[model samples]
Target: MQSDQLIVFAVLAATLGLFVWNRWRYDIVALGALLVVTLAGIVPPEQAFMGLGHPAVITVAAVLVLSRGLLNSGVVDSLARHLTKVGDKPWVQVLTLTAIVALCSGFMNNVGALALFMPVAVWMSRQSGRSPSYLLMPLAFGSLLGGTLTLIGTPPNIIIAGYRREVGEAPFRMFEFLPVGLAITAAGVLLITVLWRLIPRRENQGSDQELFEISAYLTELKVPAQSKYTRRTLHELIAAGGDEAEVMVIALVREGHYQAMPSIYEVLRDEDVLLVEADSDSLKRFLDVTHLELAAEADSKAEAREKAEQEKQAEKNGDTLAQPDANESKTDRHKERALAEAIVTPGSSLIGTTATGLSLRERYGMNVLAVARQGQRLRQRLGKIRFAAGDILLLQAREDQLPSTLSNLGCLPLASRGLRITAPRQVLLASSIFAVALALIAVGVMPAAIALVGAALAMILVGLVPTGDIYKSIDMSIIVLIAAMLPIGEALETTGGSRLIADALLEIGQSAPPAATVAILMAGVMLLSNVVNNAAAAVLAAPVAISLSRGMEASADPLLMAVAIGASCAFLTPIGHQSNTLVMAPGGYRFGDYWRLGLPLSALVVLVAVPVILWVWPL
Candidate 1:
C-alpha cells in the first residue's frame, strides 16, 4: 500500500475502534479522526471544515427542525390519541404502533418519530400488563424500515444521492427509493409483528411509573363563568370525561365547606371548586374540553395582605394590576411556556421547603402544579405542601426557564412527559408548510436541502415552532459526528484507500454474479452500520461501492442503492441507531437483547432489498 493510503487506513481503523469502544462521545472521536487526517496531509487545510457546510449536513439539520415543529404542533399527539383507542390486544397494538411510526418516519427524521411515540408505547405496555420489550424493538425496527421509502426519509439516502452527482449522474429522484424501501419496510414490519415473542420480557422498566406509582395528581378546578356546564348535573359532567375512566372526581367544595360526598345528582355551580384525581394527560384533556379553570391556590395571610397593600398603592398611583388571563395568546407569550416534571435531588435546597416559603410563583414566574411523594396521596394544596428530596413535581414555566430552573433548584428532570393542547389551526398550518416543501421536492422545483430549509424557516416565521427552540431541536451530536466523519471519508478516497478496499472486495466476489456482488456489498455496509453511526458508515462506504462497480464495468446505481439500504438497516445493535438507543431504558433492554429479533430482521432486509434493488435499478 502507498504511504498516504497507510496513514488514512490507520486513522480510519482507530476511528472505528473508538466508535465501537464508545469510551468518549462519538462526536469527539470523529473530530479527533478529522484532525489526525488533516495533520497527515491527506485533506487540504482550507477544506477541513467544509463538511459542516455540506448539503447533506444542512438537510439533516433542517429535517430535524421541521420534525420538532410537527411535534410542537401536536400532529403526533393527534395520531397517538387515536392509537390509544385500540384495546389491549397485543397484535392490534403492535400493528397500529409500527404502522404509525413507519408513516411518520417516511416524512420526518426517524429518530424524532420514535421519540414522539416511545412514551405512548410505554403507556400502552403498562395498560396492557405486558412487557415493553415486545413493542419497543418492533417500533425501532419499523422506523428504520420506513426511512428507506423516501429521499428525505434518512440521511443515508441523501448522502448516496449526493455521491451519485459526484459521479456525473443526475441525483436520484425523491421517490426513486420508495420501491425497494417500501418492500423491505412492509416485509420487515410483518415479520417482527408476528415474531415479537422472540424479544425478551424484561421487568421493572415499562413506564416512568416509579415516580408516579404512589398516587394520581389531586388538584382543584373551578367552573368558569363561561363554562357551558355551569348548571349541569354532576353525573352529566362526569359522563363528559369520554371513554377514559381513569380520572375520578374526588370531592366538591362549595361556600368554603367540603360537601359531604356530593352525589352525582348534585348540580355543579360556577365558582365552586371541584377536586379531581387524575394523571396529567387526562387532567389536561378534561379541563380543556370542559372549559374549567385551575383554581388559584390561597397564599398565607401575611402574603395576601402584602399583595393587597401593593394593589392599593398601585391604585393610588393610577396603575391597574393586570389580572392573569386564561385565554392569553401564546404568540404574545413568545417565550413559549410549557408544563414539565422534575424530581428534587437528594441534596436539593428545595427539600423541606414549601412552595409558599420559596414564593415560587412570585419570584420565578413558575407554578407548582402537583407533587408526587412515595407512599402518600397528596390531597392538600400544592403551594402549602412541603417538598421532600425524592418528591416529583409537575411544574409550569416558560420553555427557556426550564434548564436554569432545574439547575438552580437542584432538581433532576424526569422522563415523565406532561401534555399540551395545540390548537387545530396551528397543526393545519405546520402540516401545510411541510406538505408544500415535499411537493416542491417531488416536482423538482427546488433541491431537497433548499426546500427543507425554506420549510423550516416558514415554520419559525409562522410561529408553529418557536424561534428560540430551532437550534435546540437540531441534534448537534449527530451533526458533529457527520461533519467530522465526512473529512475522514474524503481523506480515504484521496489516498486511494477506498480503491484498495474495493479491489479486495472484488477479488472475493470475482467468482460470484454481479447481483451477488451487490448483496455482499450491502451486507458489509450493514455490519459496519451496526457498530458505527449509520451516516458515518454511508460516507465511508459510498466511494468503495463506486470503485467496486467501476471494477465490474457495471452500473453504479445498484451499488449505491445497496449502500443506502445497508446503512439504514442498523438493526443488529442498540448503538446502531438513535431510535434503538431511545428505547433501551424504557424497554429494560440489555446489549445482547437486540440480536434476538434484529438478526433475523436484518437478514430479511438483505434477502428482500437486494432483488428489489436489482429489479428496480437494473444493474
Candidate 2:
C-alpha cells in the first residue's frame, strides 16, 4: 500500500476504534481525527475546517430548528394527542403510533418526533394497563424507519445526498427516497405491530410516581422563635446550609397565605412555614445549619395534648368531623407550585453539570427535587448529581415560569403541564412557512440547505421560534460530528483507501451474486451503525460504497441507497441512536431488550431493501 493510503487507513482505524470505545463524545473524536489527518499532510491545513460549511451540516442544523418550530406551534403535539386515541387494541395502537411517528420523522427530526409522542405513549399505557415497554421500543424503531423516507428526515440521508452532489451526480431529491423508504417503513411497522410481544414487559415502565416517589421527600419546616435564622433572609438561610445540602424550599406560608417560589431575598420571619423537599440526610443537615424545626413538631407539649383531647372528645360525641385527606392536603399545599417531569434533551447544556454547579435554584429559580436514570431513581445528593441527556428530572418551579425554564434548560417536559400551545394565528403562520420551504425543495427552486435555513430564519423573524432559542434548538454536537467527519471521508477516497477496501470486498465476493454482495455491504453498514453514531457511519461508508459499486461495474445509486438505508438501521442498541436512549428510561428497558425485537426487524430490512433497491435503482 502507498504511504498516504497507509496513513489514512491507520487514522480511520483509530477513529473507528475510539468510536466503538465511546469514552469520548463522537464529535470530539471526529474533530480529533480531522486534526490528525490534516497535520499529517494528507489533507491541507487550509481545508482542515472546510467541512464546517458543508451543505449537509447546514441542512441538518436547519432541520433541527424547524422541528423545534413545529413543536413550539403545537401542530405536532395536537396531532399526537388526537392520534394516540385512535383505538383500544394493542396492535391497532402500535400500528397507528408507529405509522404516525414514521410519517413525522420523514419530514422533521426523528428524535423530535419520538419526543412528541412519548408522553402520549405513556398515557396510552396507563389507560390500557400495559407496560410502556411494549409500545415505546416500537415507537423508537418507527422513528428510525421513518427517517429513511426523506432527505431531511435524518442526518444519514442528508449526508448521503451531499456525497452524491460531491461526486458529480445530482443530489437525491426530497421525495426520491419516499418510494423505497415507504416500503421499508411499512414493513418495519407491520413487523413491530405483529411481533410486539417480543419486547419485554418491564415493571414500573411509565409510572413517574413509582420511579421517583418524590412525595416521600416533601416535608414542612417551621422557623421557631428561638431559631437564629428567624430574622435572616432566605438567601442567607440557604447559604448557611452549604453546597452539600440539597434541600429546596418550594413555597412559604406566612399568616396562612401561600407564596409559591419565594424569592431568595425574602426575609424569614418567626412562625413562618416553609415547604421543603429533600432526602433524609440533607434535610437533617439543612435543619442543623438553619436551626429550623419540623412544623408538625413545633407546638408545645401542652398544646399537642389539648389537640389530642379535643379529637378524642369529638370522636366520643359521635360528631362527624371534617378531616382532610393526606393526599388532598399535600395537593392543596402545592396548588400554587408546579412540579414538572422533564427529560434532558440530547446536546443540552445541562449535561455534565451538577445542580450546585449550575446554581439552578439561584439562577433559574427552580429546584431539582429528584432524578431518575434507566428506570431507577438516583439516590445520591441532588446538588452533586451531574445530569445526563436521558435523565428524568423532577423539577419544582412556579406554575407560570415552568415552560420557559424547561426551554432554557434544554429539557423536554414529559407531561402536558409545562407544554405551551401557541396562538392559532402563530401556528398557521409557522405551518405556512414550513410548507413554503418544502415546496421550494420539491420544485428544485432551492437546495435543501438554503430552503430549510430560510424557513428557520422566517420562523424566528415571525416570532414562531424565539431569537434566543434558535441556537438552543440546533444540536451542535451533531453539526460538529458531521462537519468534522466530512473531510475525513473525502480523505479516505482521495488517498485510495476506499479503493483498496473495495478491492478486498470485491475479491471476497468474487463469486457471489450481485444481490448477495449488496446484502453483505448493507449488513456491514448496519452493524457499524449499531456501534457508532449513524451519521459518522454514513459519512465513512458512503465513499466505500461508491468505490465498491464502481469496482463491480454496477450503478452507484443502488449501493448508495444501501448505505443510506443501512446507516439508519441502528436498532440493536440504545447507544446507536438518540431516539433509543431517550426511551430507555421511560420504558424501563435493559440493554438486552433491544435485540429481541431489533434483530428480526434488521433481517427483514435486509431482505426487503435489497430487492427494492435493485427494482427501483436498477443496479
Candidate 3:
C-alpha cells in the first residue's frame, strides 16, 4: 500500500489491460510501460534499456534463427513424411502427427514446430475426410506441452533460468525440465488422442469451397507486345509452363471479346488476356519467364519507372549501395523461384494498394502470383487487384529470400504443399550444426544463448542460412516484448509488489496442504497465461513463487517448476497462444470451439503435472 507500490501496480494493471484489449501492438504497449517506470523514478534511467541485452532476449532470438535454419534445410519435412504412411485412420494420424510436433518442440521453438507440421496435418485431414478442427487444436496443444521439456524449448524457460541466476542460484541446466515435462506431455498426448472426438467435425471444414475461399484457382495476365509467347500456339504456351507451374489456358479474351476454350492450334496475339488455371507458384514462373504483364493501374508502371531511375541516379553518384556483386547477381539471376502463400496483416503496407502499385517485384524481389479474398471474386488482373487485410497472397521468390521477404511485406506464411529444393548434403550440414549446439549446452560447455548464437552463425558461414537474412529471421516484436517486460518485472520486485501478492497467497495456502498449495499456484498462473502473453506471465509469477515458498519454508524448486509449467500451458482460447491463432483460419474454427478440447486437456495437465513436480522436485 506504499505510494511507490501503488504506482507500480497501477502501471502493471494498465499494461495488462492493453494486452487484453489488443487494440495496439503488444510490443508498443510494453515499451510504453518501460518508459513510464523510468520517468517515474521507479527504474533508474541508466537501467531502462538493460533488458534489450538480457541473455533471455538474446537466447530467444538465436532460437528463432536456428529454427528457421532447420526449416529451410528440409530436415523437419523429411521426418514428417513418415506420418503420411500411417494410413487414413484418424486416431493413428492424430497421435503420430502430434507426437512428432511435440518431440520437435522440445529442441526447437514450439511455434516453429507447429508451423512445419501444419500442412501435413491439413493433408491428412483431406485424405481421411476428417474436419481440420479435430486435428489442429491437438497439434497446437501438443506443441505447448513439448516446450516444457528443455531449457531452450521456449522463451519462458530461458527467462525463468535467468531469474534463477539473478537470485544467486545456478541457472537450470538443459534437461532439468524433462522429468515433469515428460510426464505431463505423455499423459496429455494420450488424453488428446482419445478426446479429440469431442471436437466437432464441421462438414465444410475440408470442402473444396472452404479451401478455395483462401486460395484462388484462376488468374488472368495480359500478353506483353515484346513477349516471345505472342506468336506461339495455345498448345505451346501450355508446354512452356513447366511441371512446377503446370497450367491450362481456359479462355482467350481479345479486345473485349470472350472466347471460351480456345483451340490448341489457335495462335496467341499481343494484348490478348489469357485466363489460366494454376497454383500460385506455377503462374508466377510462367509469367516471369514468358515476360507477360498482369493488367494494372497506370500508376504501377510509373512507380516502376521511378524506382529504376533512382537506382540509375545512385549508380551515377557512386553510392556503394547501388552496386550489386557480379557473382551475387549471376547467382540470383540463375536461382530457381518457388511459390508460397502469405496473409496480409492488419498493419501491412500492401493494404489499400494493388500489388502493381506497391511495385513488389522491383521493391522486394517478389512476384504476386494470385490473391484470395473471401466473399468476392476478383474480376480484374492480379497486379490490378487491390489488397485488403486478411487477403492471402501467393508470392514467387528465390528460396533463400522467402523468409525476409515475407517479414518485409508484413505477412504471415500459410501452410502450402511444395517440395523443398535444398540438397541433402546442405540439409545434413544444417542438422549437424544444430545438434552440436544442443550438445554444447547439455555438457555445460557454454550458456544456452552463446551456444545457439554460435550455431546460427555457423549456419550462415556454411551457407545454410543466407547472411542477408540473419537478422530478419529474428522476430523483433518478440525481442522487444521480452526486453520491455524484464524491467517492469524488476520494478514489481523492487516496489514489493511481488511480496504483497505472495503474502496474500501464503495466507490462503496456510490453511491447505503444501501439495494443494502448489496446485492452486499452478492453476492461477495458467489462467493468467491464457489472458496475457506467456512470457510476461512467467516473469511476473517467478518472483511471487519464490516469496511464497520462503514464507512456507518449503523447497523453492517445486514452486519454480510449478511456475514454468503453468506459464506454458495456454489453452481454452485462440488468443491464449500464437500457435492457436496460427491455425484458426486454416482450420475454419470459431472462437468457442477451443474450450471443447482445451478445458479437459487443461484439467489433465494440472492433475498430472502437480504430482510429478512434487515427487521430482520435493517441496
The Cα local distance difference test for each model comes to 0.79, 0.87, 0.79
Residue 479, model 2, lDDT:
91
Which segments of candidate 1 are over 4 A away from where they belong? 206-419
Per-residue lDDT tens digits for candidate 1, residues 89-206, read 8888888899889989998989778766776776788788787778988998899999999988999998898889767898887888999999998998888888888998875544
Give per-model TM-scores: 0.71, 0.93, 0.77
Judge candidate 1 at residue 5 and give its lDDT.
Answer: 91
Tens-place lDDT digits, model 3, residues 438-541:
89998999998899999998988887778777876777877898899999899888888988998998888888889989998899999988878889889889
lDDT of 1 at 403: 60
lDDT winner: 2
TM-score of 3: 0.77
Clashing pairs in 1: none
Cα lDDT of model 2 by residue, 1-619, tens digit: 3898988888888998998887888899999999998988988898988988989999999999999899888878667768655877889889999999999999999998998888888778767777888888999999999999999999999999877865579999888888889989999999999999999887765433356687798889989886788778998898899977877888898886888878998988988889988888889999888778888787454357966887899889977656545365446677767777788876677999998899887899888888988878889888778998788898888767887888888887774443355578777888899999999998999999999999999998887788888988888889999989998999999989889888988988999989888888899999999988999999999999999988998888888899999999999998899999888877889888899999999999999999999999987
True lDDT of residue 267, candidate 3: 88
From the highest lDDT down, the ranking of the candidates is: 2, 1, 3
Each model's Cα RMSD: 14.4, 3.5, 13.6
